[model samples]
Target: MTWSSMLLLAVTVERVGELWFARRNTKALLSKGGREIGKEHYSLIVALHTLWLSSLWVVAWNVRVHPIWLGVFVCLQALRFWTLATLGKRWTTRIIVVPGETLVAAGPYRFIRHPNYLVVIGEIAVFPLCLGQPLHALVFSIANALVLTVRIKTENAALSGSRHV
Candidate 1:
Protein backbone atom coordinates (compact mmCIF):
# COMPACT_ATOMS: atom_id res chain seq x y z
CA MET A 1 0.00 0.00 0.00
CA THR A 2 1.10 3.55 -0.70
CA TRP A 3 1.52 6.18 1.99
CA SER A 4 -1.88 7.63 1.15
CA SER A 5 -3.53 4.22 1.39
CA MET A 6 -1.86 3.67 4.70
CA LEU A 7 -3.22 6.98 5.93
CA LEU A 8 -6.71 6.08 4.82
CA LEU A 9 -6.39 2.64 6.43
CA ALA A 10 -5.33 4.21 9.67
CA VAL A 11 -8.30 6.52 9.51
CA THR A 12 -10.68 3.68 8.84
CA VAL A 13 -9.38 1.92 11.91
CA GLU A 14 -9.71 5.13 13.90
CA ARG A 15 -13.32 5.46 12.83
CA VAL A 16 -14.10 2.02 14.18
CA GLY A 17 -12.50 2.94 17.46
CA GLU A 18 -14.59 6.09 17.53
CA LEU A 19 -17.72 4.07 17.00
CA TRP A 20 -16.87 1.97 19.98
CA PHE A 21 -16.16 5.00 22.13
CA ALA A 22 -19.33 6.72 21.02
CA ARG A 23 -21.35 3.66 21.86
CA ARG A 24 -19.82 3.50 25.28
CA ASN A 25 -20.46 7.18 25.86
CA THR A 26 -23.95 6.94 24.53
CA LYS A 27 -24.68 4.06 26.88
CA ALA A 28 -23.37 5.93 29.87
CA LEU A 29 -25.34 9.02 28.99
CA LEU A 30 -28.48 7.00 28.51
CA SER A 31 -27.97 5.37 31.86
CA LYS A 32 -27.90 8.89 33.31
CA GLY A 33 -31.29 9.76 31.81
CA GLY A 34 -30.12 10.98 28.46
CA ARG A 35 -32.97 11.25 25.97
CA GLU A 36 -32.03 10.18 22.50
CA ILE A 37 -33.87 11.88 19.71
CA GLY A 38 -33.77 11.02 16.01
CA LYS A 39 -33.94 7.31 16.63
CA GLU A 40 -36.05 6.92 13.54
CA HIS A 41 -33.26 7.85 11.22
CA TYR A 42 -30.42 6.49 13.26
CA SER A 43 -30.16 3.26 11.33
CA LEU A 44 -30.06 5.09 8.04
CA ILE A 45 -27.33 7.35 9.30
CA VAL A 46 -25.30 4.39 10.45
CA ALA A 47 -25.73 2.63 7.13
CA LEU A 48 -24.74 5.73 5.22
CA HIS A 49 -21.58 6.24 7.23
CA THR A 50 -20.65 2.58 7.14
CA LEU A 51 -21.13 2.38 3.40
CA TRP A 52 -19.32 5.64 2.88
CA LEU A 53 -16.11 4.54 4.51
CA SER A 54 -16.24 1.13 2.93
CA SER A 55 -16.85 2.65 -0.47
CA LEU A 56 -13.79 4.84 -0.04
CA TRP A 57 -11.50 1.82 0.02
CA VAL A 58 -13.29 0.18 -2.87
CA VAL A 59 -13.28 3.25 -5.08
CA ALA A 60 -10.09 5.01 -4.07
CA TRP A 61 -7.81 2.20 -3.00
CA ASN A 62 -5.57 2.70 -6.04
CA VAL A 63 -6.42 6.26 -7.00
CA ARG A 64 -3.63 8.81 -6.83
CA VAL A 65 -4.00 10.91 -3.71
CA HIS A 66 -4.18 14.68 -3.95
CA PRO A 67 -1.81 16.11 -1.39
CA ILE A 68 -3.70 19.39 -1.13
CA TRP A 69 -7.01 17.68 -0.41
CA LEU A 70 -5.37 15.36 2.06
CA GLY A 71 -3.87 18.34 3.84
CA VAL A 72 -7.31 19.92 4.16
CA PHE A 73 -8.64 16.62 5.45
CA VAL A 74 -5.91 16.57 8.07
CA CYS A 75 -6.89 20.05 9.19
CA LEU A 76 -10.47 18.93 9.44
CA GLN A 77 -9.36 16.09 11.71
CA ALA A 78 -7.81 18.64 14.03
CA LEU A 79 -11.11 20.45 14.15
CA ARG A 80 -12.86 17.14 14.75
CA PHE A 81 -10.63 16.42 17.71
CA TRP A 82 -11.24 19.88 19.09
CA THR A 83 -14.98 19.45 18.92
CA LEU A 84 -14.82 16.00 20.46
CA ALA A 85 -12.61 17.19 23.27
CA THR A 86 -14.93 20.07 23.96
CA LEU A 87 -17.92 17.81 24.29
CA GLY A 88 -16.01 15.19 26.22
CA LYS A 89 -18.49 12.72 27.67
CA ARG A 90 -21.35 14.44 25.93
CA TRP A 91 -20.06 13.66 22.46
CA THR A 92 -21.54 10.72 20.57
CA THR A 93 -22.09 9.70 16.96
CA ARG A 94 -25.82 9.61 17.64
CA ILE A 95 -27.97 12.45 18.94
CA ILE A 96 -28.32 11.68 22.60
CA VAL A 97 -29.52 14.69 24.54
CA VAL A 98 -29.00 14.93 28.25
CA PRO A 99 -32.03 16.75 29.47
CA GLY A 100 -31.53 19.95 31.45
CA GLU A 101 -27.92 20.28 30.40
CA THR A 102 -27.12 23.69 28.97
CA LEU A 103 -25.75 24.04 25.50
CA VAL A 104 -22.00 23.72 25.33
CA ALA A 105 -20.50 27.05 24.34
CA ALA A 106 -16.89 26.13 24.85
CA GLY A 107 -14.23 25.12 22.33
CA PRO A 108 -15.54 25.16 18.79
CA TYR A 109 -19.12 25.35 20.04
CA ARG A 110 -18.66 28.98 21.01
CA PHE A 111 -18.44 30.05 17.40
CA ILE A 112 -20.75 27.58 15.71
CA ARG A 113 -23.77 25.50 16.61
CA HIS A 114 -22.74 22.28 14.87
CA PRO A 115 -19.02 22.22 14.56
CA ASN A 116 -18.95 18.44 14.48
CA TYR A 117 -21.34 18.50 11.58
CA LEU A 118 -18.97 20.77 9.74
CA VAL A 119 -16.26 18.20 10.28
CA VAL A 120 -18.59 15.54 9.06
CA ILE A 121 -19.31 17.56 5.95
CA GLY A 122 -15.66 18.18 5.37
CA GLU A 123 -14.76 14.52 5.84
CA ILE A 124 -17.44 13.30 3.51
CA ALA A 125 -16.32 15.62 0.74
CA VAL A 126 -12.67 16.19 1.36
CA PHE A 127 -11.62 12.57 1.83
CA PRO A 128 -13.02 11.59 -1.55
CA LEU A 129 -11.32 14.56 -3.15
CA CYS A 130 -8.14 13.49 -1.41
CA LEU A 131 -8.45 10.24 -3.31
CA GLY A 132 -9.21 12.15 -6.52
CA GLN A 133 -12.85 11.14 -6.65
CA PRO A 134 -15.08 14.13 -7.18
CA LEU A 135 -18.17 12.10 -7.96
CA HIS A 136 -17.95 10.28 -4.66
CA ALA A 137 -17.48 13.53 -2.86
CA LEU A 138 -20.37 15.23 -4.60
CA VAL A 139 -22.85 12.40 -4.23
CA PHE A 140 -22.03 11.80 -0.60
CA SER A 141 -22.02 15.48 0.24
CA ILE A 142 -25.57 15.78 -1.07
CA ALA A 143 -26.65 12.71 0.87
CA ASN A 144 -24.99 13.96 4.03
CA ALA A 145 -26.65 17.34 3.66
CA LEU A 146 -30.03 15.68 3.32
CA VAL A 147 -29.44 13.53 6.39
CA LEU A 148 -28.14 16.45 8.42
CA THR A 149 -31.15 18.52 7.44
CA VAL A 150 -33.35 16.08 9.31
CA ARG A 151 -30.89 15.51 12.11
CA ILE A 152 -30.33 19.21 12.75
CA LYS A 153 -34.03 19.91 12.84
CA THR A 154 -34.61 17.02 15.20
CA GLU A 155 -31.73 18.08 17.40
CA ASN A 156 -32.81 21.74 17.39
CA ALA A 157 -36.32 20.82 18.41
CA ALA A 158 -35.06 18.60 21.21
CA LEU A 159 -32.60 21.18 22.45
CA SER A 160 -35.07 24.05 22.22
CA GLY A 161 -37.63 22.08 24.14
CA SER A 162 -35.11 21.27 26.83
CA ARG A 163 -33.00 23.67 28.89
CA HIS A 164 -30.47 24.14 26.12
CA VAL A 165 -30.92 27.04 23.68
Candidate 2:
Protein backbone atom coordinates (compact mmCIF):
# COMPACT_ATOMS: atom_id res chain seq x y z
CA MET A 1 0.00 0.00 0.00
CA THR A 2 2.78 2.41 0.85
CA TRP A 3 5.62 3.35 -1.45
CA SER A 4 8.14 1.61 0.72
CA SER A 5 5.97 -1.47 0.89
CA MET A 6 5.62 -1.48 -2.88
CA LEU A 7 9.37 -1.20 -3.24
CA LEU A 8 9.93 -4.07 -0.84
CA LEU A 9 7.40 -6.15 -2.73
CA ALA A 10 9.24 -5.47 -5.95
CA VAL A 11 12.49 -6.50 -4.33
CA THR A 12 10.94 -9.68 -3.01
CA VAL A 13 9.62 -10.50 -6.45
CA GLU A 14 13.06 -9.88 -7.93
CA ARG A 15 14.61 -12.18 -5.34
CA VAL A 16 12.14 -14.91 -6.23
CA GLY A 17 12.99 -14.55 -9.86
CA GLU A 18 16.68 -14.75 -9.06
CA LEU A 19 16.15 -17.86 -6.98
CA TRP A 20 14.38 -19.48 -9.89
CA PHE A 21 17.27 -18.58 -12.17
CA ALA A 22 19.84 -19.80 -9.66
CA ARG A 23 18.03 -23.08 -9.23
CA ARG A 24 18.05 -23.65 -12.93
CA ASN A 25 21.75 -22.87 -13.12
CA THR A 26 22.48 -25.09 -10.17
CA LYS A 27 20.77 -27.99 -11.84
CA ALA A 28 22.61 -27.42 -15.06
CA LEU A 29 25.96 -27.15 -13.34
CA LEU A 30 25.33 -30.28 -11.32
CA SER A 31 24.50 -32.13 -14.50
CA LYS A 32 27.78 -30.96 -15.88
CA GLY A 33 29.73 -32.53 -12.98
CA GLY A 34 29.83 -29.48 -10.75
CA ARG A 35 29.71 -30.22 -7.04
CA GLU A 36 28.19 -27.92 -4.47
CA ILE A 37 30.36 -26.87 -1.59
CA GLY A 38 29.41 -25.59 1.84
CA LYS A 39 26.01 -27.18 1.81
CA GLU A 40 25.95 -27.26 5.61
CA HIS A 41 25.80 -23.51 5.98
CA TYR A 42 23.49 -22.85 3.07
CA SER A 43 20.30 -23.00 5.09
CA LEU A 44 21.57 -20.47 7.59
CA ILE A 45 22.47 -18.09 4.78
CA VAL A 46 18.98 -18.47 3.32
CA ALA A 47 17.29 -17.93 6.66
CA LEU A 48 19.36 -14.84 7.37
CA HIS A 49 18.45 -13.27 4.06
CA THR A 50 14.79 -14.20 4.37
CA LEU A 51 14.60 -12.76 7.87
CA TRP A 52 16.38 -9.60 6.79
CA LEU A 53 13.87 -8.91 4.06
CA SER A 54 10.93 -9.88 6.28
CA SER A 55 12.13 -7.54 8.99
CA LEU A 56 12.37 -4.72 6.49
CA TRP A 57 8.82 -5.37 5.39
CA VAL A 58 7.54 -5.35 8.96
CA VAL A 59 9.38 -2.21 10.09
CA ALA A 60 9.79 -0.12 6.97
CA TRP A 61 6.52 -0.49 5.10
CA ASN A 62 5.28 2.90 6.27
CA VAL A 63 8.63 4.69 6.25
CA ARG A 64 9.51 7.30 3.69
CA VAL A 65 12.28 6.35 1.29
CA HIS A 66 15.46 8.35 1.47
CA PRO A 67 16.52 9.60 -1.91
CA ILE A 68 20.27 9.34 -1.29
CA TRP A 69 20.08 5.83 0.08
CA LEU A 70 17.74 4.84 -2.74
CA GLY A 71 20.30 6.10 -5.21
CA VAL A 72 22.98 4.01 -3.55
CA PHE A 73 20.71 0.99 -3.65
CA VAL A 74 20.19 1.53 -7.38
CA CYS A 75 23.95 1.65 -7.89
CA LEU A 76 24.33 -1.61 -6.01
CA GLN A 77 21.75 -3.21 -8.29
CA ALA A 78 23.81 -2.11 -11.26
CA LEU A 79 26.80 -3.91 -9.78
CA ARG A 80 24.63 -6.93 -9.15
CA PHE A 81 23.55 -6.93 -12.77
CA TRP A 82 27.14 -6.69 -13.93
CA THR A 83 28.20 -9.57 -11.75
CA LEU A 84 25.31 -11.74 -12.94
CA ALA A 85 25.88 -10.88 -16.56
CA THR A 86 29.57 -11.68 -16.25
CA LEU A 87 28.96 -15.07 -14.75
CA GLY A 88 26.03 -15.76 -17.00
CA LYS A 89 24.99 -19.42 -16.74
CA ARG A 90 27.66 -20.01 -14.12
CA TRP A 91 25.94 -17.76 -11.63
CA THR A 92 23.94 -19.43 -8.87
CA THR A 93 22.94 -18.81 -5.27
CA ARG A 94 25.06 -21.74 -4.17
CA ILE A 95 28.77 -22.48 -4.19
CA ILE A 96 29.08 -24.77 -7.12
CA VAL A 97 32.41 -25.60 -8.71
CA VAL A 98 32.84 -27.67 -11.79
CA PRO A 99 36.13 -29.43 -12.21
CA GLY A 100 38.45 -27.82 -14.76
CA GLU A 101 36.25 -24.73 -14.90
CA THR A 102 38.17 -21.54 -14.25
CA LEU A 103 36.81 -18.88 -11.98
CA VAL A 104 35.26 -15.89 -13.69
CA ALA A 105 37.55 -12.90 -14.23
CA ALA A 106 35.37 -10.53 -16.19
CA GLY A 107 33.29 -7.54 -15.20
CA PRO A 108 33.23 -7.01 -11.44
CA TYR A 109 35.08 -10.24 -10.99
CA ARG A 110 38.13 -8.66 -12.49
CA PHE A 111 38.28 -6.28 -9.57
CA ILE A 112 37.04 -8.47 -6.73
CA ARG A 113 36.95 -12.17 -6.07
CA HIS A 114 33.33 -12.16 -4.92
CA PRO A 115 31.44 -9.41 -6.62
CA ASN A 116 28.01 -10.95 -5.97
CA TYR A 117 28.69 -11.06 -2.25
CA LEU A 118 29.79 -7.48 -2.40
CA VAL A 119 26.51 -6.56 -4.00
CA VAL A 120 24.66 -8.54 -1.35
CA ILE A 121 26.54 -6.75 1.41
CA GLY A 122 25.55 -3.44 -0.09
CA GLU A 123 21.94 -4.54 -0.46
CA ILE A 124 21.60 -5.71 3.12
CA ALA A 125 22.82 -2.38 4.41
CA VAL A 126 21.55 0.02 1.77
CA PHE A 127 18.05 -1.36 1.44
CA PRO A 128 17.25 -0.68 5.09
CA LEU A 129 18.92 2.71 4.99
CA CYS A 130 16.76 3.62 2.00
CA LEU A 131 13.75 2.87 4.15
CA GLY A 132 15.14 5.01 6.99
CA GLN A 133 15.93 1.98 9.12
CA PRO A 134 19.47 2.38 10.38
CA LEU A 135 19.12 -0.23 13.09
CA HIS A 136 17.78 -2.69 10.61
CA ALA A 137 20.70 -1.99 8.36
CA LEU A 138 23.20 -2.50 11.14
CA VAL A 139 21.67 -5.70 12.43
CA PHE A 140 21.35 -7.37 9.07
CA SER A 141 24.75 -6.16 7.92
CA ILE A 142 26.39 -7.78 10.94
CA ALA A 143 24.50 -10.99 10.42
CA ASN A 144 25.39 -10.99 6.75
CA ALA A 145 29.05 -10.43 7.55
CA LEU A 146 29.07 -13.41 9.85
CA VAL A 147 27.44 -15.55 7.19
CA LEU A 148 29.81 -14.26 4.55
CA THR A 149 32.81 -15.17 6.68
CA VAL A 150 31.87 -18.79 6.50
CA ARG A 151 30.73 -18.51 2.90
CA ILE A 152 33.86 -16.78 1.66
CA LYS A 153 36.11 -19.25 3.38
CA THR A 154 34.25 -22.13 1.83
CA GLU A 155 34.31 -20.52 -1.58
CA ASN A 156 37.97 -19.74 -1.31
CA ALA A 157 38.84 -23.27 -0.34
CA ALA A 158 36.74 -24.60 -3.17
CA LEU A 159 38.31 -22.37 -5.73
CA SER A 160 41.80 -22.87 -4.39
CA GLY A 161 44.29 -24.55 -6.74
CA SER A 162 41.92 -23.91 -9.65
CA ARG A 163 42.81 -22.02 -12.80
CA HIS A 164 43.62 -18.31 -12.70
CA VAL A 165 40.78 -16.09 -11.59
Candidate 3:
Protein backbone atom coordinates (compact mmCIF):
# COMPACT_ATOMS: atom_id res chain seq x y z
CA MET A 1 0.00 0.00 0.00
CA THR A 2 1.10 3.56 -0.57
CA TRP A 3 1.74 5.80 2.42
CA SER A 4 -1.53 7.66 1.84
CA SER A 5 -3.45 4.42 1.67
CA MET A 6 -1.85 3.16 4.86
CA LEU A 7 -2.51 6.41 6.63
CA LEU A 8 -6.13 6.45 5.51
CA LEU A 9 -6.52 2.88 6.71
CA ALA A 10 -5.18 3.86 10.10
CA VAL A 11 -7.50 6.84 10.27
CA THR A 12 -10.44 4.70 9.20
CA VAL A 13 -9.75 2.22 11.94
CA GLU A 14 -9.39 4.96 14.50
CA ARG A 15 -12.67 6.52 13.43
CA VAL A 16 -14.54 3.23 13.58
CA GLY A 17 -13.15 2.53 17.02
CA GLU A 18 -14.23 5.96 18.13
CA LEU A 19 -17.73 5.33 16.83
CA TRP A 20 -17.91 2.16 18.86
CA PHE A 21 -16.71 3.94 21.96
CA ALA A 22 -19.04 6.87 21.43
CA ARG A 23 -21.99 4.56 20.90
CA ARG A 24 -21.28 2.75 24.12
CA ASN A 25 -20.96 5.98 26.00
CA THR A 26 -24.10 7.37 24.44
CA LYS A 27 -26.03 4.30 25.43
CA ALA A 28 -24.76 4.50 29.00
CA LEU A 29 -25.58 8.15 29.24
CA LEU A 30 -29.09 7.61 27.92
CA SER A 31 -29.64 4.84 30.40
CA LYS A 32 -28.63 7.26 33.10
CA GLY A 33 -31.24 9.81 31.95
CA GLY A 34 -29.04 11.82 29.66
CA ARG A 35 -30.76 13.84 26.95
CA GLU A 36 -29.53 13.90 23.39
CA ILE A 37 -29.77 17.27 21.73
CA GLY A 38 -29.99 17.97 18.02
CA LYS A 39 -30.60 14.40 16.96
CA GLU A 40 -31.63 15.70 13.56
CA HIS A 41 -28.15 16.83 12.66
CA TYR A 42 -26.31 13.76 13.87
CA SER A 43 -26.79 11.74 10.71
CA LEU A 44 -25.61 14.57 8.50
CA ILE A 45 -22.52 14.91 10.63
CA VAL A 46 -21.89 11.20 10.24
CA ALA A 47 -22.41 11.32 6.52
CA LEU A 48 -20.05 14.24 6.12
CA HIS A 49 -17.29 12.58 8.07
CA THR A 50 -17.83 9.31 6.25
CA LEU A 51 -17.59 11.03 2.90
CA TRP A 52 -14.58 13.03 4.00
CA LEU A 53 -12.67 9.88 4.85
CA SER A 54 -13.92 8.07 1.78
CA SER A 55 -12.83 10.90 -0.45
CA LEU A 56 -9.34 10.80 0.97
CA TRP A 57 -8.85 7.45 -0.70
CA VAL A 58 -10.36 8.53 -3.99
CA VAL A 59 -8.66 11.92 -4.05
CA ALA A 60 -5.28 10.91 -2.70
CA TRP A 61 -4.65 7.29 -3.54
CA ASN A 62 -1.37 7.95 -5.32
CA VAL A 63 -0.30 11.00 -3.43
CA ARG A 64 2.84 10.83 -1.34
CA VAL A 65 2.80 11.82 2.31
CA HIS A 66 3.67 15.40 3.10
CA PRO A 67 5.63 15.29 6.34
CA ILE A 68 4.64 18.73 7.59
CA TRP A 69 0.94 18.06 7.17
CA LEU A 70 1.43 14.68 8.76
CA GLY A 71 3.00 16.43 11.72
CA VAL A 72 0.00 18.72 11.96
CA PHE A 73 -2.34 15.74 11.85
CA VAL A 74 -0.35 14.07 14.63
CA CYS A 75 -0.63 17.14 16.80
CA LEU A 76 -4.36 17.30 16.17
CA GLN A 77 -4.59 13.68 17.22
CA ALA A 78 -2.89 14.55 20.48
CA LEU A 79 -5.43 17.29 21.15
CA ARG A 80 -8.25 14.96 20.19
CA PHE A 81 -6.97 12.35 22.62
CA TRP A 82 -6.53 14.88 25.35
CA THR A 83 -10.08 16.12 24.82
CA LEU A 84 -11.38 12.57 24.91
CA ALA A 85 -9.45 11.62 28.03
CA THR A 86 -10.54 14.70 29.87
CA LEU A 87 -14.16 14.11 28.98
CA GLY A 88 -13.78 10.37 29.74
CA LYS A 89 -17.08 8.49 29.39
CA ARG A 90 -18.83 11.76 28.85
CA TRP A 91 -17.40 12.15 25.40
CA THR A 92 -19.85 11.08 22.74
CA THR A 93 -19.72 12.21 19.15
CA ARG A 94 -23.29 13.40 19.69
CA ILE A 95 -24.40 16.17 21.97
CA ILE A 96 -25.70 13.95 24.76
CA VAL A 97 -25.98 15.89 27.94
CA VAL A 98 -26.07 14.20 31.32
CA PRO A 99 -28.46 16.08 33.49
CA GLY A 100 -27.02 17.87 36.51
CA GLU A 101 -23.48 17.47 35.23
CA THR A 102 -21.44 20.61 35.08
CA LEU A 103 -19.34 21.70 32.16
CA VAL A 104 -15.87 20.28 31.68
CA ALA A 105 -13.29 22.98 32.22
CA ALA A 106 -10.07 21.05 32.25
CA GLY A 107 -7.51 20.04 29.67
CA PRO A 108 -8.26 21.41 26.19
CA TYR A 109 -11.66 22.60 27.33
CA ARG A 110 -9.94 24.91 29.75
CA PHE A 111 -8.43 26.87 26.91
CA ILE A 112 -11.19 26.73 24.33
CA ARG A 113 -14.95 26.47 24.20
CA HIS A 114 -14.79 23.70 21.60
CA PRO A 115 -11.37 22.22 21.20
CA ASN A 116 -12.68 19.13 19.44
CA TYR A 117 -14.24 21.19 16.67
CA LEU A 118 -11.01 23.06 16.11
CA VAL A 119 -9.11 19.79 15.89
CA VAL A 120 -11.70 18.41 13.49
CA ILE A 121 -11.60 21.51 11.32
CA GLY A 122 -7.83 21.24 11.18
CA GLU A 123 -8.03 17.57 10.26
CA ILE A 124 -10.54 18.15 7.48
CA ALA A 125 -8.42 20.86 5.94
CA VAL A 126 -4.95 19.57 6.70
CA PHE A 127 -5.42 15.92 5.72
CA PRO A 128 -6.43 16.79 2.20
CA LEU A 129 -3.59 19.27 1.96
CA CYS A 130 -1.29 16.45 3.06
CA LEU A 131 -2.17 14.76 -0.21
CA GLY A 132 -1.71 18.04 -2.10
CA GLN A 133 -5.45 18.13 -2.65
CA PRO A 134 -6.27 21.58 -1.49
CA LEU A 135 -9.53 21.63 -3.43
CA HIS A 136 -10.89 18.67 -1.53
CA ALA A 137 -9.76 20.29 1.69
CA LEU A 138 -11.45 23.52 0.79
CA VAL A 139 -14.74 21.86 -0.08
CA PHE A 140 -14.90 19.74 3.04
CA SER A 141 -13.65 22.48 5.29
CA ILE A 142 -16.41 24.79 4.10
CA ALA A 143 -19.02 22.10 4.56
CA ASN A 144 -17.67 21.27 7.99
CA ALA A 145 -17.77 24.90 8.94
CA LEU A 146 -21.40 25.15 7.93
CA VAL A 147 -22.28 22.04 9.84
CA LEU A 148 -20.39 23.27 12.87
CA THR A 149 -22.17 26.58 12.86
CA VAL A 150 -25.47 24.79 13.31
CA ARG A 151 -23.97 22.28 15.71
CA ILE A 152 -22.45 24.95 17.90
CA LYS A 153 -25.70 26.81 18.07
CA THR A 154 -27.65 23.68 18.94
CA GLU A 155 -25.17 22.66 21.62
CA ASN A 156 -25.09 26.10 23.13
CA ALA A 157 -28.87 26.24 23.26
CA ALA A 158 -29.03 22.85 24.90
CA LEU A 159 -26.46 23.78 27.48
CA SER A 160 -28.14 27.03 28.19
CA GLY A 161 -31.50 25.39 28.59
CA SER A 162 -30.08 22.89 31.05
CA ARG A 163 -28.05 25.59 32.75
CA HIS A 164 -25.01 23.38 32.42
CA VAL A 165 -21.75 24.48 30.89
Q: How high is the CA lDDT of each candidate model? A: 0.88, 0.93, 0.91
- Encode model 2's per-residue lDDT on 25-95: one tens digit a residue: 99999999999999999999999999999988888899899999999999999999898899999999999
Error of 1 at 14 (Å): 1.6
**Candidate number of the best TM-score:** 2
Which segments of candidate 3 are over 4 A away from where they belong? Answer: 161-165
Candidate 3, position 16, lDDT: 96
**What is the Å distance of residue 161 in model 1 from its true position?**
3.2
Task: Tell me how many clashing residue pairs each candidate has.
Answer: 0, 0, 0
**Which pairs of residues collide in candidate 1?**
none
What lDDT is reached at residue 19 by model 1?
91
Per-residue lDDT tens digits for candidate 1, residues 1-165, read 886678779888889888988999999999999978899988878988888888988877877889999899999999999998999888898888776678888899889999999999999999999988899999999999999999999888878855534
Candidate 3 TM-score, C-alpha based: 0.96
Best-matching candidate per lDDT: 2
**Better by lDDT, candidate 3 or 1:** 3
Cα lDDT, model 1, residue 22:
97
- Residues 1-165 of candidate 3: C-alpha lDDT, one tens digit per residue: 899989888899999999999999999999999989999998889999999999888888888889999999999999999999999999999998887888888898878989999999999999888888889999999999999999999998887755435
TM-score ranking of the models: 2, 3, 1
Error of 3 at 123 (Å): 0.5
